[model samples]
Target chain A: MSADVELQKVSVSFGNFYAAKNVSVKIEKGEFFSFLGPSGCGKTTLLRAISGFAEPSDGKILIGGQDMAGIGPNKRPTSLIFQNLALFPLMSVADNIAFSLEVRGTGKVQRRNRADELLELVALSGQGNKKVHELSGGQKQRVAIARALAIEPAVLLLDEPLSALDLKLRQKMRTELREIQKRVGITFIYITHDQGEALTMSDRIAVMNEGELEQVGSGHNVYEAPHTPFVASFVGENNAFYGTVISTNGDMVRVSSQGKDFLAKAGDLKDGKKHTFQKRDKVIMFVRPESIFLKDQINQADNIFSAIFKTIEFEGNLKNIYLSIDGVQDVRCSISNAVETATLSTSESIELKFSSRDAVVLPVGPLAVD
Target chain B: MNYFFNKNGPLISTYLIISIGFWLIFLIIIPQLYMFDLSFRPNIPTLLRGGPDDVYTLVHYKHFLFGSETSGERYNYVDVRVFLDTILTAILITLINLCFCYPIAFYIAKVASAKTARLLIVSLIIPFWINELLRSFALRILFAGEGFINNVLIKMGVIDTGINFIAMDVALYTGLNYAYILLMIFPLYNAIETLDKNQLEAAEDLGSSMIRTHLRIVIPHAKAGIASGCTMVFMLTAGALATPVVLSSPNTFWFTQLIYQWFNMNDNWPRGAAYSVVLLTVSVVFVLLMMKIFKVKIGEIVR
Candidate 1:
């Protein structure tokens, strides 16, 4: 029941604007694949294209080695869970879950049985008689998943299904969704704007922006070795500094920004080629806040810079220290919530250090913010 | 009283609320009560020719079931027959409107582009801005012995002789459907518009055909609007006086015409009042029945 999905130069254009442009990816069978991006980044559009809700202007999409050309959504062996879940409000939970069977003209007894079986799978056993409205939000979410699964689709497409739930519920459902996907043993293509969710659940994550794929890899690889500045800045909190490469040796590059020079790692990303940067090339170097530490914490590091402490933001378990380095880029470093970290809130100035291997630099391109 | 006072941020005083309440009773509610009261009494006009006599009887109500008591002929079931005919015709007009307007409503709300939707709405509403009476008259001319419809059909060789369509039931239904199309379309548009497009997509993704998508999902979601629209259209068509008077053939006698004749021509005010009351009761019953059958609440319908 599982099938690998392949997209080759897929492009979905709406008049003058391309919603998904030249996007290509290979989703393995029974794998949890996620498209992570900001709003209007074409992730949802690409999902729709895969589900056949949207047509590609150019390129091909093949499921199970069959080209999906001129195929409608109903004919595609794929099911899409809408952002709102879109459960039939007037129908009972069982009826909503068994709708695919009903549409295929399955008998009442069989449909009811299938519905009951799916409910049990989703941990909602013996609740088939209740109407959809009677269920809580999380229950409704499970019912939606059951409905999609009842169709026995080869690929289950979820378009930010947990976005409407509260934070705690969303976090809980993330694990539940992953468990369900594993149990079903089908390719699960998820579209979301939440990076934490993608990082937690996805076997492989595709970071998209402006209708194009910026980077695609395992969660750790994407975060630790991003191919582009957009992926580095967009995936997580990163302190970005724009400057020119003063020297290049082997795979290491010395980049200068705001009249200060810092050594940064530039080598072959594990199992992937590194984007080579030449000397005098203007580049935007990105270093994750969590990568930087107090100067005393790591002595004699590959890169070190100091700045005046601006403010500290307390976020329950962690605190972020914002600082300005020589009236240049604003740098932020996050530390665990501790007495020592709390005392730094009153500090006027701070010193920071990070290893060259922890930093990523790409040729000057469109920054995530601007 | 307090509700009204606070309705406009405390400026609506007790006196104002009382005055409006009295105005409603006098102008609307009281008249209905009086009509029901007069329906139970004799038709004898007083010396002053205002209100009914003191005596009350079931004769007027019985007259609706049976024939006129004073008539010499064995059968005078014209009033009951006309009443039934009116109900049947109103239902027909409502069905026609539903069939005609659902596609247009769905198109404007979901499929058409923003500019096209605006243009369609304006086109549908602009014609209804003209008085209903005038619109019927315009149709009357078009359906006359040598009017536009007959002339075009004749030229197209669809028919050799011109048909007198002005006095046909088709003309009446066409007028009723057009007159109340905006009411039906707006409610349907409002309901169907609020339906998240994802639901329709979800239905389609689950192997449902376009027809089944509407039947199982879109239509159920829009039951409230359908109930409200059908209620209004049925009531309006059944109570309409001008369309029947102008469009119906001499052979056709609408219930409203019978009421008109009783009140105006025959001066049988009691009988007219009885007919009015009966019509009002039937309309109310129909509204409740529609809501019940659709399982839509009053709150849902009004919205």
Candidate 2:
């Protein structure tokens, strides 16, 4: 039921601009794969190329080890659920679900039965007679899923199908979509701009930026060990200190920022990680907000910084204490709400420290800014 | 009525109401009432200056429908057939226009680029800017024995002799189709332009062939436009007088031409009014039937 998707240096160009430039990635069979990027980042273009709507200007798309260049979307072993759902508004719910079957010249009774079974699978069994307009947003999403599943394609391509729904429904649907993919045991390529969605449902994610594949790894790896500056900033909140490496160790490096040296995780030498940044190479040190702690909690660490507490942002469960440190733009410490956080003064100087393993240093490139 | 007051204050609302009342009385209701009265009474010439009969009768209606017998000959039966022929011709013209205009409409609305669509629109409108009567007369010359078409065909070695296109009803069909094409194209353009392009792509992605895509999606979505275009074209074609008279031979007469003869040539206003009322009834019933058949609402059709 599932198939691997491979692209061997596929490039999609439009006259002078390349929508997707030499992107090469593979989705393992039965894996929940996601392409996460902001709008116009060529994520959708890559998806369209795989689905056969967009013809790649160069290279090949191989599905299950077969070249899919000449095949169309209808002939290919893939089905795409459009962003708008594109459910036939004039058809009844059952008919909309059974459209693929109807086009294949299936018998009426069999198509209706299949529609009913899929409807029940989606938890909309008795509502098959209703029009599409009568259903709620979540129900329509499920109907679209059912419609695409009726083809029983090897890969199901979804193009931000949940973006139109409200937040609560969208959140609930993310789990349902993952469960459905697991139950069906098919390769699902989900395209979304929301990192939260990708992190929640995808087993592996390919982060795209400006028509380039920035990083491709599992959700945990992409979030915790981003390979580039863009991924470090875009995937989650991180405080960046721009500097250059002063020295390199076995799998770590000493980065100097504003005459202060701190040891951080670079990468494994055997695997050629961190793009193998050498001594005196310009790099950016990124530490997650949650990784930084008050100096008292950490007696000794590779990095320690002292700054004046400027302001505290109360965010329900956690509080962000903004600090203004000299020679650095600003440093922020994320601490759980407590009596101490509430009692912190605006001008009081404080010290914060983080473990060297928690801080990563990579060669400076593009950073995702607001 | 309260809409006027709500949108416009007392002064403007008063003016709106008065104008609406005047429009309805003088333009719509009074004319229809007069036609209804005329249809019910006997024909009275202007020279006689006789008032309508004290009691209304269906004699004029009967005479229009079933000709009055005189000298043991059927008098007005040909006109009745002429009326039926007129309706049938109108229906044929409407269908031809639909088949003819649908592809071009699709090209303009969905397929053509912005520049090409604009060029096509200008091309379609520029020719029709000429007066309709002159256009029909021009067509009459174009379809003559040695007209543009025959000359082209002969020069291309397709025909040995000149073809008489007008005598075979070709000119009438051509003129009517040309006249009412805008009514069809514009409505279809309006409808098809609003269809989301993704819907078509989704259908294609779902493995629907081109024909099935239209049958299940595009055509059903454009039903209102089809009904509207058909209704307007049918009414216009059925009631046409100038095109048929100018294009056809002397023996051919459209139903409107017969009605014209009754009112002006024969001085039978009562009979002409009766025929007109019947024509109006047919058109209304046709519109309703079209709406029913297409499963479209009157509001959707007019929109």
lDDT per residue (tens digit) for residues A1-370 in model 1? 9999999999999999999999988999899999999999999999999999899999999998899989999999999999999999888999999999999999999999999999999999999999988999899999999999998999999999999999999999999999999899999999999999999999999999999998889999888888877888888899888899999887788999988899887733434877678778888888888888888766768787788888888998888888987766899998777637644644367878998888877877676773
**Per-residue lDDT over A1-370 for candidate 2, one digit per residue giving the tens place of the 0 to 100 score:** 7899998899999888999988888889999999998899999999999999999999899999999998888888898999999999999999999999999999999999999999988889898899999999999999999999998999999999999999899999999999999999999999999999999999999999988888888899899988888898999889898899988887788899867788898842213445567888998999888888998766877688777889988997888888877735588788878637656788888888999999988888889866
lDDT of 2 at A218: 88
Candidate 2 DockQ vs. native: 0.79
Model 2, span B52-107: residue lDDT tens: 44356787677766677552445567777888888998999999999999889988
Highest DockQ among the candidates is held by which one? 1
CA lDDT of each candidate? 0.88, 0.88
Docking class of 1: high
User: Which ranges of candidate 1 are over 4 A from the true structure?
Assistant: A267-271, A342-349, B1-11, B48-54, B70-75
Candidate 1 local lDDT, residue B218: 87
Model 2, residue A288: distance off in Å is 1.2
Candidate 2 clash pair list: none
TM-score of the first chain in candidate 2 relative to the native first chain? 0.95
TM-score of 2: 0.95
